[model samples]
Target: MSLQFIKRIFTSGVFLISANVMLSVTSAHAAVNIQQWQTSVGSEVYFVENHDLPILDISVNFPAGSARDTADKSGLASITRYLMTLGAAGMTDEVIANKFADIGAVLGGSFDTDRAALSLRTLSSERERLQALGLFANILQKPDFPESVLAREKARIISGLEESSTQPESISNKAFMSALYGKHPYSLDESGEIDTVAKIKKEDLQAFYQQFYSAKGAVIAIIGDLTREQAQQVAELVSVGLPTTPAPAPIASVPAKNQAKEQRIAHPASQSHILLGHTGIKRNDPDLFPLYVGNYILGGGGFVSRLTEEVREKRGLVYSVYSYFMPMAEAGPFQIGLQTKKDQAEAALALVHETLEKFLNNGVTEAELKAAKSNIIGGFPMRIDSNKKILDYLNVIGFYKLPLNYLDEYNKKVENVTAAQIKDAFNRRLKHDHFVTVIVGDPKAE
Candidate 1:
């Protein structure tokens, strides 16, 4: 059958099904309507059409993540992404800024270990959409890689790197990644090191672009104020006249962390920075919902988290303490981090370790489980309520090839996760013994 015929059948018909029967399932968990189609140029789009608002939030994603950077030239991919909008086609960064400002839209870009994305939020009207879309297209397909702007961006990045090297938190986090991943790409910093940033060139950027930004590796997720027909057009419109090569780069492999380390750095800051973690789960893992819910009790829930409660409110060790797992295409970090008065740092770190070990051993308390579930489920809708939020979710879905209804099932998955399930997942997955401990403010007293 033709591709056109498949799409026609995909969106229109209601086919009957028995409980055991499944036909090319989209998302079994989410009951919400999620429309998906591949554009003629091969950009895939996921849509949740809500016409109630006159705004559109669209996100385009690619596998151009930091992991793809050259091992010898770490941070190249990241600098490439950051420099994308500085100049594209014939437009300077100033001109690009003016273009978006003129249209009353926002163009945003971000990347992590495994994916890079550019997002646009605009009035869904025709004129605004055209302007916004034009900028996005230009950046994707025609980034000029102008030498002058590249120089300026490098200087700016180098300055930030210099500043960060002095920062207690930055120093501590960098140490933790080095400890966690060893020689793996996950251990590399996205912003790169001072020496690497200084050595980057425009041709290097262009070569990297040519190698990575191809149709085969690209996924476009468009939502708001577009029909199926228009979305198909958008795929073509956005990805047209691009690099013609098939995807050639290998997807990065993040090795499982086998051990952990501890280190300390001296700084003049009033508080000591601490980071403890090891390798984390992947982005599309089945265990994501369970881990996410479980993490809230660990530290992600702010004042309600055991970390914050033990370190901040209960004992006044630090002003703030938190934990999060990055979850990307590759396994990322599951980190518990905080800062405390230099004098209190050693005691706080010991308590945090004990607390984590306790949680890992016994799981969250019953009250903690209920509170985490209530907060996560209750606050879920606010995440996807606006077009911008929808686009953000769509970006992840599109990039990761997630089920079209990932958001639809989000609440249900969280709802169905049992406390026992959470505990089991933690014990099965989180290996606290291999933690990479980094303290960047003072040495623990001898």
Candidate 2:
């Protein structure tokens, strides 16, 4: 199952009671009206007021993801973000955890290639909301980055990196990113390498935090039981004490690949893990709609995709094969990943290439186009079924500077994509001959 689905299942029980209460106030099809503004401290705010449930969800984002790290300090951004919640404003990690539990609140974070985010979920009642918002603001404005916690977290992360280094999937992923991105910041693993992470000190984290986690660069997304005035107050409180430095420079451009290259690493595993592709579009690329729809037909539609039909069912060369375009602030990888017996690796790879070539040459049929549109547009509501989900969309919209109507017009964009548009997008955005390939477990290894 997908990680998102798994997360939904895991967290469903925690919010079951609140979700039922919300049903009486609003239907699943309620419209989302987002309000956008900026705080006096220069933080941008996106608000969606929904009193359906007595719950509030807030996410604060900054341009402090791994892409902001220097080569020598590859994992600095992630570790800094983690340390913020562990201890802040004179509170120990245990104390912070206990306080949140007492208030029935949840604290979480997301770190990726482009941004770092801290999220909070809590009851919207006056007492509970005030307590939760106060603690959240402290974590954002006054992270202590204790030395003892830093050492422990460093050890834990190093242990994980060591273990993952020995796994074929990890091996292939790191190699694949390095091959595709080269010297770009995106190539650095979010979890810093052992050598680099070990050298990181408490001072480094404090400096990094001050530099990238400045108020001027903050994007605060708030959804749930709050009025426009209240949201403004909350934004001001969260951003009040943050550093007032200017926003950091934009990330460097992702370099283009000019030739196809393959790297094969020998391993003792019985199956070969393969990854191949080149840099694709950014989040705001004009071809986003057409490319998204076309990919559904090419390899993203599960068993119904052209890749699965050609490589898995017809020839039985592999159990599963999939491709996706991960659009980021900059061009992200357009990756196709698969696994098969070592003996069948070459055959699976060949069939994948053949299928991609045919799909590009012929484009998608009208029937395939209709089905893709139907599947994508039909499932749009589920994307914003709850306050928490809408909070996520607000974060994306504010951080990426996308049109406020992005979620509103999502289905229309998908419906308007034609076969010709899909064909042209695919042809212009992807060059099969320039793909970079990484394989773990040498197919010829015996």
Candidate 3:
């Protein structure tokens, strides 16, 4: 789904990895060695050589996502990345699509808050790999951002945006983010408003792409059946043509909002969608493991989480409820989201607040901590079982500048987190009085 260009880029296939092997290797973080180096073109490259299969996966990440968009040009980054594959070096989008298909290679991309990326997976054979990489290079460096294609895509996206605006969940999410982030860049909707997107000209996209998608601003994550030398070559081939400039400055921090803000919008929907939270930790925060484990205990653990237990099982307020902290380049959101019958909206909201307060004050019980650690540690192997998953972690590590041994240290880190650590981490980072809450739906008649 991150690859927004085409819905079906590759056939439905999972890169099979041995779950048992992964489970057994939990003690060793060096299960797969990650080689890191800078390319000739200034791109930071992270390579993991896996010859288990004749598959090659490479992801090129740029600090050019929605966060980089100006207040008025909210969707420009996403639009630019989407259009890159449409036309490059005068080849139309159809020609590019056909080229990949003919080679049995897949080209895809994703756009998010802190980054945009283009990814490819292809057979490791020289013929196929070269063909795919060649096309990828052109898209990365020589994107035409053709005027006609721009117009078409803009219209398509605008239509989708217009449709989404009518949906309650969409409305709720937008309102929630706007309230949470205030005027910070993170507040902008991932997709721009219809008016803003309509104003995004080819010139706008070109300017944004040129400044933000350069080699210095990128990270190349390569995983598969390739040698270190080949990975170096692959990294260079894709980035060498990019403008060699200094990396841009880090994004501004989310302005602190010490006051609790609540936005209520009436909708005809039968269920109320409620979301609440505040600015959370950054990717590299020292408390990352503690927060991760704590969140799993709080609400991220699904069926076993405190939220699910109190909100759903004890009171049956909602069918499903969850919470998570998204640690990005800067502090991302720590959010709890749920939907319940319109009549019970207020009760559900109160219960959520009460439970969070109690957990924040008392922290998790020893039994709860043990359960969370067990679940997290037991499930850790599945996270790195596949090359694609490993590639994703590598991309994040390179982009966020995480420690190279992060994967190896993951299980141990979770295991080492004590109940006091979780409680202390949450107490320090989370402020109950300063959170933003948004509810969308008509309240039931009392």
Candidate 4:
């Protein structure tokens, strides 16, 4: 079937499900009227007023991720964020949880290398909205980092760390990142070593929060049943209590040049977990579109992808093999990961390396490019079929300073990516001899 025919069927009501999906796509891409502004306290606010739902979703992001942790205090940032919701002002953790539940509101948050975020979803009614916002602001600005709670969380994290050390997947991932980033802060796992986590005192969490959780570092994305005026007010409430200071400068990019190295750990696992790659592109890299489309065709598109076809289907060496580039503030790792029987690990690795080299030299075919773009474009609506998903995109765009029309332009950008562009971008960014490899399990000796 032609693209136009699919579009017509989806855009029209011949099928209710397809029509509804298309309507969601239209609303997300075309009606995503993001209004942006800066609060007096220096927080950047991105707002979208959607009255179709009687719910409100607000996410407040800060530049306080694990990357900001000092080497000695590696997990402080994550612990600080986790503790923020536990105890604030005079309220206990139970009190905070009960307060949100009493009013039918939900509290959520995340921690990663480059960012820390806290989110809220609540009914848009005045009583619930005001109460929830009040609770959120308190958690953001008035976190107590209670000493008893600190000890308990530290014990919990250390226990988890001790368990993770024996897991093959976790061991390989940690070692792979260390090899890929060397001394870079990005190498540090969000969950720091047991020794470091055990040493983190309550004072450390308080100090870290005070230093990095400033108004200027805030990226507030608010969406739902609220007027622009109300959104402005909500943004102010979220950050007004924060200290007014500019955020720290962006982290430096990972070095593009590095010596290739291999790390093999002796583990008694039945299968070997292998991971390989090097520093990839940053969020604002010029070749973002080409690389995005190219990676999909190479290994990210599942069964149709080249890596899957060669490593899994043709040889039956493994159940799955995949590759992806994690676009971040600095150059993130371009990882190709897989698992295979311990005896077949060497063969699997050789095939993977050959597949990558061949694709880099020859690039994808026209048919592959066309199918990749079609699949990516067709799947766009599923990405933003809900308020939470749209909120996530909005939050990222605001946090990373991405263009407001990123969602609308995404499909067009994929459609325009050419095979030549993919080859050129891939060749320039990924060097065959400069990647780091980590394998955990018994394999043939070199």
Query: For residue 253, what is the lDDT in candidate 4?
Result: 66
lDDT per residue for candidate 4 within 1-446, as digits (tens), equals: 22343234323444222232211211234747777777767788888888999999999999888889877888999999999999997899999999999999999998899999999999998778888888888898899899999999999999999999999899999999988887889999998888899899888887788778999889998899998767766776778788665687788667766589998888878889999998898887889999999999988999999999999998999867999999888998899999999889999999999999999999999999999999999999999888899899988898888888888888888898999999999999999899899999855532
Give me the runs in candidate 1 sitting further than 4 Å from their true place: 1-32, 248-250
Order of models, best lDDT first: 2, 3, 4, 1
Residue 212 shift from truth in candidate 2, angstroms: 0.4
Estimate the TM-score of every prediction: 0.89, 0.93, 0.93, 0.93
User: What's the CA error at residue 23 for candidate 2, in Å?
Assistant: 33
- Window of ten residues with lowest summed lDDT in model 4: 17-26
Regions of candidate 4 where Cα sits further than 4 Å from its true position: 1-29, 444-446
Please give the RMSD to the true structure for each candidate, in Å: 6.0, 8.3, 7.6, 10.4
Model 1 lDDT tens row, 219-333? 7777777665555555665666457667646566777666768888888788788888878888888888888998988899999998998889989999889999888777878
Candidate number with the higher lDDT (2 or 3): 2
lDDT of 1 at 51: 76
Candidate 3's residue-wise lDDT over 245-285, tens digit each?
Answer: 67878999877668999888888888999999989989999
Q: On a 0 to 100 scale, what is the lDDT of residue 242 in model 4?
A: 84
Residue 310's lDDT in candidate 4: 93
